[model samples]
Target: MDALQGFGELGLGSRLKRISEHLMKEGQLIYDHFEIDFDPYLFPVFKLISQKDGITNTEIFNAVGLTQPAVTQSIHKLTKKGLIELIDDDSDKRRKIIHLSPKGKTLLKQLQPIWKSIDSVIKSFGMETSSSLISHLNSFEHKLKTHSFSKSVIKSLGNRHHSIQISTFQNSEAEKTAFYDLNEEWLRTFFYVEPFDEEVLSNPDKYIIDKGGHIFFTKLNGEIVGTVALMPLPKQNTFELTKMAVSPKHRGQKIGQQLMQYCLDFAKNLGLPNLILYSSRKLENAIYIYRKYGFVEIPVEPDCHYKRCDIKMEIVF
Candidate 1:
């Protein structure tokens, strides 16, 4: 076992790092052979900026799988190298957009064939290894987002307890407040709220109800105890289950399950192909309920809006 030891059972980080370093080393050689002054590690960020021009630094970070600081550093390096520039958005004075410079565009033109060659090699690597390496990496990252390694270790440590009823989100401002309150309570308790959370929770009527999504609330004696949202995707009979929240004090009452059942039934009645959801592994009881309803894991969509989403699951008819 020692002779054939791999990252020692749970060394996903180490394994990934080693794999990235190996590829980067080979990639650097390719760059050197071509005398391209660009670092291969910086390529993803550059390419992301090119593809998502006028996007914020944080957007580039999310799209390219890098930390905010790392992305910022790369941006600075590119700025210095005359490959890109950061311009502030006019309407939003605080927003800065990332744009590729003409030099960068020209460089990419020169490197296009080299990129094709690397692409071919990557495709061959997938065939030789009998794995879709890039896709699997994406799926792995998505799974990690759904559940952190730390929570995965400790979720089943103790028993869970809660119970509660379901109500649909009417246009009433009171229900609107409750929806925000329930979801915000859960987010603040388990994870800090991201900008996307703020946007959705702040304006469910505008972003959800008006857009044809449904919000269901769990009730206890006519009091809104929990809430779940069903967001319809454009041009598809698909719905994304999102913004589920049961008040912290009311968790053990199993309100979440009841809400989930109602949500599922709602989708099923709509005759949709499936219902999709984004959640983390840390929410053990929730995931259990989802899986109980036959929610199997699937790869997350690349253009997913939420940074908090790590796992994509579906309940197909």
Candidate 2:
């Protein structure tokens, strides 16, 4: 039998259908309230233009996976509505730069309150529930992108319950030392290049104390099994997710996804608008997580210390 029939046999089809309908209605309500002609295509286009000003129409089409004419049509409508404007590129006369018009900015400003209302509704449900939904969405997105792993792996991972925990690291020596010792081998084996420094390992308290970065660990018992670090970026409203390492024995357990969810929630709680990360294709699992979390690959900057890293991912909140 097909998937739908199987789900019906399991008595879950009706529930699943209800969920789908609820989500569809909720999405439509959001778009309607914003007074913007909402389509699946428009959200990404708006996100791209809002974040990367002066983007060309061709670039927007490519980035958002839309046909040139379709994008142009949408742009024309938005322009007529006074939400966007096309300007001639000084460097390349052949290309026209797309930007949010003053009216677009005003709409965005107006929509901010609506977005916050939606967010508040979600938050009212509680942090754990919101975090769980975000985690599931991120996982689904990652699976679609990488096309890695087999059906068996997916099934096994799906059966497990993943959770995130956030806490401030106590400025205590023993706790810090213990975390370092437990994670040392996992870090060494997974991140052979640019392994956690001995100094940092020897003094976790000092590292967090002096550096002011939050240390988040993932535990599957009394033992710490995975970790991710959020360090301050040079500029305000941004942070770097670093030192994300999961124990080899727990590789397929979806521990990495949980850790990433924790980091994302941490950033969101701080009201930061963006989070940046550096990773290598060597760790396919990690790259998949980054992409699953709405991160897009960007040009790598020079003077990056990790020689193995050739990819950089950034997510704008």
Clashes of each: 13, 0
Off by over 4 Å in 1: 1-164, 235-237
The estimated TM-scores of all candidates read 0.48, 0.46
Query: Whole-model lDDT, candidate 1?
Result: 0.70
lDDT digits (tens) for residues 237-311 of candidate 1:
678898888765554445666677888787788887888888876554456668878999999878777776778
Q: Write one digit per residue (lDDT tens) for candidate 2, span 173-279.
A: 64565566655665454444344455556665565446667887776655566676787656444677876665544444456677788888878998888888877
Best prediction by lDDT: 1
lDDT of each: 0.70, 0.61
**Span of ten consecutive residues with least summed lDDT in model 2:** 148-157
Per-candidate alpha-carbon RMSD to the true structure? 17.9, 19.2
Off-target runs (Cα >4 Å) in candidate 2 are: 1-166, 172-174, 191-209, 235-237
Q: Which candidate is the best by TM-score?
A: 1
